[model samples]
Target: MAKEAKKIKKVVLAYSGGLDTSVMIHWLKANYEDCEVIAVTGNVGQEAELVGLEEKALNTGASKLYIEDLQEEFVEDFIFPTLKAGAKYEKDYLLGTSFARPVIGKRLVEIALAEGADAICHGCTGKGNDQVRFELAIKAFAPNMTIIAPWRTWEIKSREDAIAYAEKYEIPLKITRETNYSKDGNLWHLSHEGLDLESPTNEPKYDQILEMGVSPENAPDVATEITLSFEKGIPVALNGEKMASVALVKALNKIGGANGIGIIDIVENRLVGMKSRGVYETPGGTILYFAHQALETLCLDKETQHYKELIGIKFAELVYNGLWFTPLRAALSAFVDETQKTVTGEVKLKLYKGNLTKVSLSSPYSLYSEEFASFDEDDVYDQKDAEGFIQLFGLPITVQALMAQKGEA
Candidate 1:
């Protein structure tokens, strides 16, 4: 059952300065008996979206706006852990928006608690995964706090309803009827959904909707090569030059974006039990994941590496389902960290026309031995030993066949 939003004196809203949120500030006041609304917008690398947000929030009716700079923490704390775990939702999505929700939700709770706010509000629609992501994180931190999800209880039904409410209230919005596509952007990636993208049969209008980079068809002919360095599984440098986490992602975004890399269109299963289509441009994150995996290849042993693949799939599901702060996720992260102790290394990659080609990879803790793997004569390993090993390995199969041959009923 949805929680009741009653007796709420003050509410803190997760404001994005987008269409829904911009209209929400005014709607909350009108519907919630004119409750005091304080808006909080986390600066998780929504570059242009941050512009004049304070003025917009204040103008619309928010008492005050808090735009917290969470880019560095978003990368170091959330992104690196997922990257190290090799978590990719459904083998494609890099969990850009998925991992970002918890960080922002945590900050929302902080601001709400500090301001003595009675309830927290959000503009997420009822059918979206973000509503689950935001509310779960909020409940984890502030279990007693009231969560006011207007979409579930309000008269507004769809994007059209939202725009009508905004128009009725004389509220300003950046999106129009023609360009009203649902978008989520942060440092790691930019995602586009809704409109023509909702139809699986229709090809994405990449030429018109792409914001982070150009389409693969229009990518530059020449390949772009870059060297990336990692320490304890976190990206620390690019092209042999050390950089801060945020700077490194930004730099790689520029390079990878130019090369038309890291764009994926997927029909993902939402936690709401619906399949939604989206196109994600994760240039920097794609490069980082590729490089990290290359380093792991040289560092991790077969057993550990293969087992970690299962862990990665689970990690992806957890993040996609918005279980970021749970104990299982933490335990998994700890195990990934242990594996990453030897994940310190450098990887050189060539990016061209949306393709990532590994040029070279090296690590100090590399387990690869050229001598044992070589076809030429080597004293390190004896080929004759394989006979006994294969015999033991095939014992179960041999016994099953012998039983059948002897007709042992």
Candidate 2:
């Protein structure tokens, strides 16, 4: 530890401009023997959190601050790809915080290489998934870059300890220690943890915890209908109006938020070998997932759709565990891309008090045929063929039953 610490002359930090990171800038300098700290923050649609971030980092003993606008890239490159892959961690999570880490980590590596820094730093604690996500991405990008994870090494034991450190350093803090909830936000979603959420049985105080949008109970009574257009599986238009990827998510956020469309609470299995409760707010993303699924139903064949669902689970696990830069992920993405070739379509949905209903879906590559499926015996199929097909399909089950009957005889 001493040798590595001495070798790290300069470090690029994945600074969030949050309380933990504010403490980190000063802590790194104090502990690392005059290590130059460059704070790198990604503007992944954190809304108000990005305000005065540069000033905060500079004031907190950082040599410089790099704030990258990653909203467009985040949506287009990360979110859309995940959406197209149909990846959902633990069946409920949209992998909001999961995928955001890779992009930030990638940028951190780029900055470190450009600045000729020996190490990269992050405020992520050892217990959480983000630490793994950040570190794995660092290893993938720069195998030899020393990683400084202060939470694992520092004497600070809890948020209270962190607060004390902040006070000692006179680090300006907007984060209140009173609120035990830990929150992470990006263009994709908002995640809340800690506090009363530590207890799985305790119902979340929605009024206090809710931020990105209103709760379902507070949603308006009237339903709002919206139309979305997809081009090769990417959302291109909202309400029939063309918009950029970032613009589309922003628009859906407002629409979905107004209708109380997205809120998921689950006790998910963490990669670090523990179950943790997470309350996620992904208003726009939820709508997109549902709408995208509807489009795939029309475009993808039955076999491809079923197979892709299996891939989705694996994709979610990969993203959650921070393997975004790996070859498997790239290959999976290529497969997802191929499936999306005929996924262009328009979907109409109605949002009412947290309920998103697909009103209609139409695609140029739709495989639905009313004539073939008609109950009145269409020319495309004969009813007798179904009997033979069913018998063939059920042969294994029939044989098992017949063999059991022979044993009884």
Q: Write the per-residue lDDT of candidate 1 for residues 1-409, one digit (tens) a residue.
A: 2133357769999999998899889988877774899999999999999999999999999999999999999999999999999999899999999999999999999999999999999999889999999999999999998898889888889999999988988899999989999999999999999999989999999999988888888999999889999999998888889999999999999888888889999999999998999999999999999999989999999999999999999999999999999999999999999999999989999999999999988888999999989999999999999999999999999999999989965
Collision count of model 2: 0
Segments of candidate 2 deviating more than 4 angstroms: 1-3
Pairing residues by index, what is the TM-score of model 2? 0.97
TM-score for each predicted model, relative to the true structure: 0.97, 0.97
Those runs of model 1 whose alpha carbons end farther than 4 Å from true positions after fitting are 1-6
Model 1 — which ten-residue stretch has the worst lDDT?
1-10
Q: Worst lDDT window (10 residues) for model 2?
A: 172-181
Query: What value of lDDT does candidate 1 attain over all alpha carbons?
Result: 0.93
Model 2 C-alpha lDDT versus the unseen true structure: 0.91
